[model samples]
Structures are given as C-alpha cells and as structure tokens.
Target: MEQVFFNEAAQDLKTIHDLLRWSVTCFSAANLWYGHGTDNAWDEAVQLVFPALYLPIDSQRDMCSGRLTYSERKRVIKLIQRRINERIPVSYLTNKSWFCGQEFYVDKRVVIPRSPIGELISQEFAGLISDKPQKILDMCTGSGCIAISCSLVFPESKIDAVDISEDALAITKKNICRHGVKKNVTPILSDLFSNMPHKHYDLIIANPPYVNVKDLKSLPHEYLHEPRLGLITGDNSLTLVLRILGSLKDYLAFHGIFICEVGNSMSDLITQFPDIPFTWIEFDQGGDGVFMMTKEQIIDMINLYPIFNV
Candidate 1:
C-alpha cells in the first residue's frame, strides 16, 4: 500500500480550503459524538485519506489543520459519511484496534480485542509469574489474539488455543502467522475442553461466552458484529462457567492457575455460590469479568460447582 501523500499547498487556491472547511462542518454536524472524542476518531479518518488535514477548532498546537485539494478533501468527507451511514465501527473500517498499545488485525468475523488481558500480558502477568507456566491453554480462543499476546510475552512458554468454530480458528491461524508465533501457539478446534488432550496445562485461561441469552441480544452494534458463539452462554452463563470450573481442575497441573473472563456473569457467579472465593484481577487498561483460581483452590471449591443441563 502506498503511503498516503499530500500535494504541495496551493498558495492562491481559496476554493480547496473553503470546501474542506465546509466538509468538516458537515462531518461535525453528522458525527458530533465521534468528532468530539479525545482520540478524534473522525479527525483521524479524515487524516487517513486526506493527508493535508488541518482543522481550526480545538487544535491549537501541532498537526491539526491544513489545505486539501478538492479530490483529497472530497475523499475524507465521503469516508466519514460512509462510516455514519453504515454504522460500522471506525475501528473495523480502519482494520485495526489498539491492544496493549499494539495494533492488531480485526474484522466482522472476530470480536475486537478489548479485553484487559492484553494489558495484563504486557507486564508479563504483572510479575505474577512466580511459577512460570510451561504450557498455557487459551479456551475459546476466538481470533487467537490472546494466544498471540501470551506467546509474545512469555517467549519460552508454549500455547494451545481452542475454539469450536473453524472460521474463528482460521482467523486465529492468520494472526499466528501474522505475528509469526505459529511454532509456539497451537490452534485446536474444540468445544471447550471436549477435544483437548488431557495434558497438564500450567495455566488455563478462558474468555468464554459468559453473556446470558438476553444480555447477548442487547449488546451494542459494534459488539453484535462479533461471533455470538464466543460471547453468548445458554441456560444462564452458568452452564459454561461451571463446566470449566468443574473440569478445569482435572486438566491443570498442580500449582497451575485457571483464569476465566465471565464479564457480567461475575455477579451471577457470586449470587449462586455465595461463598466461592474468586480472585478478581485488575488490568492497567479497562476491562472486567475476569477471575483467577488455582488447581488447589478449584479442588477445595469443587463443591460449589453448579450441575446445570448444558
């Protein structure tokens, strides 16, 4: 792809600047919510196609406004208009989203990588690696973003990414190849732990479908674009969570840790168990619905598992 370029400014051309000013005016009128954002998502969109971008408003310092010829100015306005019309997230249109300050590929097939897990992995589990896991399992690894981040952070550890869908696994493969971690991150098409080999994983991590049926249906448009199988849980999100909590102890090695992201289901998990002690993890970036437990903890807390008809 050619780097977007800007022609030399026309000293005598007032028409170009006038058109651009009106274009931004129209963009602000149509996309005020996005225009006013700190990241300036709309302004960024304008800059992508219109490299000679400069606006007079709120940009009192560096690189905010400039002159774009008619064609360049027209392109940026149309792009922002397309975003407003389609309701597709600007992130998808850009084919990128920030995770742990690193840009990653994302599309409608996979959920955008927003889990705080990325931030956690950046600090190498926040120096939480008293016992370095030899083998790691990423359950329901949709786009394999988590697996790729883990492999990058822990260069010596091997990773296994499991999911039931071939489409998701295919994307996972793409990311593995993109990040060049194919040798370290293995992909498995499995329903939970059903198809996984009974190997002892030092750390088993999951960001499974914990959104209850009703809750899943009401997610925002950006989230609706993602695959529901990895986000929705049936018969209450408890079904899948309990299944993992019950069977995880069997698959984890002694001193092994199990990390699961249950999101809103954390409240439900607590109400149901009443006494199940789960370690809620905090991320440097924003995220919720994640909890941690050990193999010994799982064994001791085994009685709290709810036997649901999954």
Candidate 2:
C-alpha cells in the first residue's frame, strides 16, 4: 500500500498539532459519519489523536505544539488509517468510551455509551422523580453505562443491570469492576423482565435497540462495528421496546419513573399508542426520541392499549 500523506508540505506528521490537523482533513475527506461520542470531524480527530498519544483529551492548550516521537507518530497514523479505511468508531479503536463524564472500557462486544440519559442522571432525575431512587433498573444495559452512572449519582441506591446478551453482560461486568461499583451495581442476565427477580424499582432506564429494518440497512459503517443485538430492535423497530413496556409496570414501584430511548422510532411509538401521554425529555446536549413515563401513566397506557397486556 502507498503511504497516504495528510499534509503535502511535510513528509512526516511530527507535532501533536500537525497530526490533529491532518486527521481532521482525512476524516472530513472520508465523509465519515460521527455520533459515537462526537459530532464532528474536529472533535473526532481530537478523540483519536490525544488518546493515541497518551495525553489528556483536554490537553490541547499545553500540548498542541508538542513534538511526537517516531513510534508515537506511527501509532497515531495507524489509528487514523483504521478510522478512515475501516470506518471504525474512535471509541472502539481506543477501547474506551465516556458517559456522564466517566470513562468505561468498550469494544465490539458492546455498543459505545452515548445515551443522553447521562444528563438526567447527573441532575438526579430532578423534577421527574420526586426523590432519590432507592432501587434502579437499567434494562438492555449494553456497557452497564446507565447502571454504573446511576450508582455514582445515587451512592445509596442499589442497581440491577439487565441484558439478554451474555456477551454484552460480560462487558457490563467489566465496566462494573472498572468503576468499582460491585456492591451497588449488579449485572443480571435477563431478557427484559422475563428473568428479573420480583422487585419494584424506583427508577428504570433503558437505551434499548430501536433501529427498525429500514434504518438498519442504511446505517453508516461506524454502526456496523457495534454489536447488531444492541442496535436492531426488530423489523418494525418496536418489538423489544413494546415488550419492555408490557412488563415494566410489574417491576416499577409506585411513583417510579420509566425512561427509554427509541431514537428515531419515536413517531412509530407515538402512533402505536397515540393516547398515552409520554413525556419526551429535551436534552440540552442534543438527542431525541427518549421518552419518560411514570408508573401510573404506564398502568394507564396498559389499560388503553390492551395489546401490551402480556
């Protein structure tokens, strides 16, 4: 293979600033889609370059002009090539992802943690849930990101991180240990609520698989790297989500809050049960299709839409 020169002026990219600039140009030219923790080429480049160089992501102020060793240049270049040629997400390449301001180990075994529920967790689910939850449930917990984040926010609360995929649960357990929440956050192998212990949770949050058949087919290459089980909900995209709704009331305690992310399937969900008054959360950092409903509302929904009465 021929050497790809990101900069025509220099035979080799030397400084951190040089590599950062070059990566942005290559990423922009590749027309790569960003969404796995970053939204633009510049941010994506910074994520790739800084981590590859063993520097802080926020260290651009002091290290932008710092020179890179020959070996360091090679590592950064190789990661850049993979980012462009293979279209792998930077998080997967680095085996790291950040959620709610904390880092977690990640790879192809689990989907990268990018849920907006982090914002709500940081806010202690304020104005939505009247009190700090004593028991929290994270359904479809891919990397245990939500469950672990909840553990940090609610140190006194116990959390159950449930996922159907054993492979995903392995990653979840690793993250659990990584964050040292073994006492509070417990990983469970369950298909929704099918295997869940008969316990009521004060807060239940899920970033479930909501990609329908149509969107799944057209997803970018970056998404292809994530586990299919974590992304595709069903043919109509509501299969898993509907199942969650059906059993959630059984496990959700009185005055509890239920939050789930359907992404672009929000319209389909609304159409399926038009009468249910779902409270859609508005994230200031930019994400949509996450709906919240109290336990009372969920019971009301079950009454109105008997199809969910399973």
Candidate 3:
C-alpha cells in the first residue's frame, strides 16, 4: 500500500466527501482493524467523518459534497491521524457507539458495544422467550448497552447490569442514564453472579470475555486498546463460560432463557460438552458464536451429570 499523503494545496479536497475518501485511503494504507464497530475502511471513514462534522451517519449523499470548514478539516485530519497511528477504534475516538439501533457513550473503560446479542434483544427474544421478561440480567455488561436495550424492549422489566470492573460499571451507569433507562437499569459491581447469588432473572444475556489466551496475543492492535478483562478468558476461552453455566441454573427463572456470546470458543464449547444441548443462534444482520438455552434444558443437563457441580 502506498503511503497516503494529505495535501492541503489540493482544491478538490475541501468537501466532506473528499475528507472521507482521504480517510478511507489512509485507513486502508495503515491496515487498521475494523472489527470494533465497522468491518471496512469505508464504513470506518463514514463513522469518523460523520460524527466529527456533527452529521448523522445516514445523512444524504449531497451532504457529503458539502464543503468542510477549515476547523472541520483540521479536526477530521487529526482524528484520522490518531486512528491510523494509535490504532484506536473510531468508537473510542468518538466516545460513542450504536447498538440495536440505539446510541451509547463509550470509551476505553468499556468494550465497544459490538455484541451479536443485540440482534436477539432487537427481536425481544421472540422464538426463544414466550413471556415478557419481568427480570433481566446483563452479566458482564460493559457499557450496559444490552441492559439498556432490554429496558427499552421490555419496558416493564427491571435489569441488573453486572461487571467486575468498577470502571466499566461507571461507564455503564453513564450509558444507562444517557439512554434514560436509569429507572429500570441498575449497574452492579460483580464478578459475574457473585454479588447476586439470591437474585434471579427471567432472561439472562451475556457477551463475556471468551477470547482464548493464544488468540488474545494475536488480536489486532485496535483490539488491544480495549480492557483485557473484557476479552481474554483462559487457554480454551471457556473458563468464565463454564463458571457461568455452572451457576446459571441457580439464578434463572423457571422458564428463563440464557443467552451468551462465546465468540470463537463456540467450537470448544460444543466439543467440551457434547451431551449438553446448546442452541446456537443465527443473526440475519451478521454475527456468530452466540448460543441460547432454556432453564429446563440446563436443569436436565445438571440432572444427567454434575455439570453444574463447579
């Protein structure tokens, strides 16, 4: 890739479209990772440019042709430089991320909200859940996006958003308040379900740190900016997952649904527990490594073996 040179003398580079194009070029040249919130240079460019210019991401194409002011140009250039050089995720740069069609404030303190669990929340867990969840638990909730989304989806439900990191819980509180779901969503400091042994939920959703030790070392530079506690698990990436499964039955309602995203550890999960029935969820919007199981299914598995003996 040729080095992207930003030329101030170029007259054609005055418009938003020009800056966006230049950003895309620079991002591609730098080989920046886009798995944070976007999957490609173009989308990442849009995310960087649109937010910097105070424009909506879905703004009209004609708006892109609008000329950028001198200050706007400088700001966009600086952002692009940091993006390329620091390998920071655009969401962290902008301090904002969108999940389940809702916007939430984000920073390095919490992982960017990119969980596929959002797809299930958007559908209100249709096929998997029959009744409207009265109690919800967003275990390992980073920015509390899942819990906040659930509060909106199930207006009558009260949600507990738990995270072991106080910093993450602080951010989660801000997001819950930002989304105006503070009344229904509570941020709790807990290492999984440790702080809520007696509490139970009708629906429990988690996007835990399932990245294996080996994969963690090989993650792109952009991912390195995120908190390690929110990504790495163990050698096989099933340490925390197994712990969650072991204690899940005790905290789930009679007909509760437990949904979790194990990322690349899905294969390991299947291999480790071949007898357990794990319903891998498919998303039309594009995401994988998530699975769902009902309370009854968990109970049956517990009965068959001492799976939950941990």
Model 3, residue 24: C-alpha shift (Å): 1.7
The digit string of per-residue lDDT tens for model 3 on 1-310 reads 2224443513347988888888888888888888977899999999888888788889948698798777778777878878887888999888879999998889889989998888888898889888899999999999899999999999999999999999999999898878888889988898888888587789998888988889978888889999888878767688898788878888999878899999888898888889988999889989899998988888787777675664
Candidate 2 residue lDDT tens string, 44-100: 999888988777788998999998877788888888888888899999888888899
> 1 or 3: which has the higher TM-score?
3
In candidate 1, the residue pairs with backbone N, CA or C atoms under 3 Å apart (3 or more residues apart, or in different chains) clash, namely 54-64, 54-65, 54-66, 55-64, 55-65, 263-289
What is candidate 1's local distance difference test score?
A: 0.69
Prediction 2 TM-score vs. true: 0.96
- Global lDDT of model 2: 0.88
Off by over 4 Å in 1: 1-76, 304-310
The C-alpha stretches of model 2 lying farther than 4 A from their native spots are 1-11
- lDDT at residue 54 of model 3 (Cα atoms): 81
RMSD of 3: 2.1
Of 1 and 3, the candidate ranking higher by lDDT: 3
Question: After superposition, which runs of candidate 3 have C-alpha atoms over 4 Å from their true positions?
Answer: 1-4, 7-12
In model 2, the clashing pairs are none
Please write out the lDDT profile of model 1 over residues 1-310, one tens digit for every residue: 0112112222222344344454455445555333111245445444333332434333423333445466655555445555555545555665555555554666677766667677677877755558667899998887788888888888899999998988888888988898899899999988888888889998888888877778866665445656678667776887788888878867999878888888778888888877778888886556777888888878877854445323
